[model samples]
Target: MTGANKQRVDVAIVGGGMAGASLALMLAHFCPHLSVALLEQRALPDADASVRLPSFDTRATAIAAGSLQLFSELGLWNQLRDYCAPIERIQVSDRGRPCGMSMRAAQQPRASFAGMLGAVVENAALGPVLHRALAQTQTQVLAPARVNRVRMVADGAQLDWSAGAGCPDTQLQAGLLVVADGADSPLCRGLGIVTERIEYRQRALVTTLGVQRDHRGTAYERFTDAGPMALLPLPRRDGSHRMALVWTCSEEDAAILRELPEHEFIARLQKRFGWRAGRIERAGRVSDYPLSLSLAREQWRRNLVLLGNCAHFLHPVAGQGFNLTLRDCYGLARALAGADLAQNSTVGLELLEAYGRDRRLDQQLTIGFSDRIPPLFASPGLFARGLRQAGLLALALTPPLRAGFVGQAAGFGL
Candidate 1:
């Protein structure tokens, strides 16, 4: 601890993933007067340009339109535009049903161009982009730093951490603390935060595939007998039509599928995905993630506030986890920038309550979708399937309702 009169940072953000880095950049770039420091444990992100996903990690997140707008406002969507694939239409269906429910761009009131519902990018691509932006900002990046201790007191929040390999720990004091750590956040737990978590006995197998028919910016969400599967289009870089696949199934089935021969796995996927995209020629090495939903009782405590997966972790089936985190990050930045800095820190009860107030409904709505979809979509009985199919028909046949659903998926509903 510095006994000298050293200046304290206005905010110290822990974890430099998309949520942390994006928010840090916003705060530093817009309100540079507010001293902000971003702490990341990795010495550095991988520097190899040839490696897209790197080995062992193969997940991709579906970026929603609202988030894309937020990124656009931050002047980042343009940077990612070429790298991501636009989703022009979404087809939600019950495989056993008679037909599919489609929410198309033409239904919207747009005068020109299909209102892109959203875009999909390799998450591997996202980390590097945000990290690069973070590096460009004046915000201090504590590379290879670990949080050894965190203390929140009446005075302020204190963080003890070690930077560089084999180095002594250093202490930092901040008027506000941001916990942007992932799903299993130690900082939140260390502060005795309560979270509701559900472990579905399923795992999602994700990968990329080359298809015969062009995706034509069409994305498919199919409820299979085994589980739910989504096929999202990716923008072609080399005149090649590419698609990203997310297949959810029982854990045992996922393990078995992962072990199958490459051709065998592709065949299985083809049968489930059908001939809409023609032959499913190739499949990347699969990525597996256990499905779950986690929600922290409170997004803030004392001089501390939680954001991103640290605050709420949703089922990937809904693609709402990262989108929600981005919203939280932007909201936090907005809330901080609007407040009176002389009389209050960004970590005060009033600020926390205000953030909670503005965001609670949105969070709840997304959570409810994640919590509801899996069970309903995963139902085994014929009667349940019949009911779901009927709902799909309703959605497809009803123009106003279909547009509303499409708007939500496109990120325009909010």
Candidate 2:
């Protein structure tokens, strides 16, 4: 009903997932005078309930040091701190190799919170936290809304959408349009922005596992012949040590693994990951996603910008997908905060251009690292295997290089 009459805002975000919600918050904090609108397809559950968007499912994301600082700057870190589990150590190993590299929080000079490498927060907790924060802001949120059409007009972009179930169709006008609608964004396609996607021929199987021994704030990344298996630390209600598992494998192998019994699944997982974190006591629901490196050929158009997975989707190798986007959101917010919007209804081209230019290096590095590293470690070739093991050995032996790597992983490379 609210959209029945044309509503005008300075920024209209098409998807209210992490990136979109984050941008709304950033605007609310830094540019409170600017009117903002967010249109989301999924409706939030009742206040007491916690059903979350599929994008923000049960999967846990590794929050880098830089991201934590950014959240703190935005006054959001306190809200998320309770749900986070610190990643104090990371052990990277090859399945058949004799040696591996261990990155400790103490090894990096800048590591904070008693040498915390990073932190992990489950989506089930994060999504609601974000939505609640959005609710507290002045940004208008329209959920369970279906966007029927988007048109680029001379003044700005116009959205024809219907809010809620059986709601009447309404129109909205915005000076700038932000598309954070994930990788398969119809809006991006409609705008003739082609995606360059490289299929890795692998699928990521994700689940949470209860361990017999405490994880001790350590994350393990084991590179097996099948693919990479990463076990990130988590906290359980029963005071049990939980680890979030992200295992990459061939499609056929993934199919087999997904159907295996809990006991059998844990057995197989232990074989690949070893007894580093001790025996896996139990397994949770398993979910799988196809792995790919996808980038939008064009991220910006006149009065329009794309963010997050809509702009680029990276392999989950380093868990850099969300981290990179968070940085992008921060940059865009800074650009908007400093720009003079009084002269025009929409943000100026100069501001947009500068923002794009600023993000180019970070995007290229993050995307390239995610794209190249997975295959190098996952490769079955003898040369690739040797290279990976040797690289790990060198990293272990070289302190300066290791510190640099840690800094990069902390998202300080940009």
> How does model 2 fare in lDDT?
0.85
Number of clashing pairs per prediction, in order: 0, 0
Candidate 1: segments with Cα more than 4 A from true spot: 3-7, 46-58, 109-114, 237-239, 343-346
**Which 10 residues in a row give candidate 2 its minimum summed lDDT?**
48-57
- Model 2 residue 83 CA deviation (Å) reads 1.2
**What is candidate 2's lDDT per residue for 139-245, written digit by digit as tens?**
89988788888998887899989876677779999999999989899988888889999999999999888888888889888888777889998865465668899
RMSD in angstroms, all models?
2.8, 2.7
lDDT of 1 by residue, 122-238 (tens): 777788777776766778888788988888867678888888658877888888998987888888889889988889888989887877778887888888777788888875644
Instruction: Give the worst 10-residue stretch by lDDT in candidate 1.
Output: 49-58
List TM-scores for all candidates, in order. Answer: 0.92, 0.94
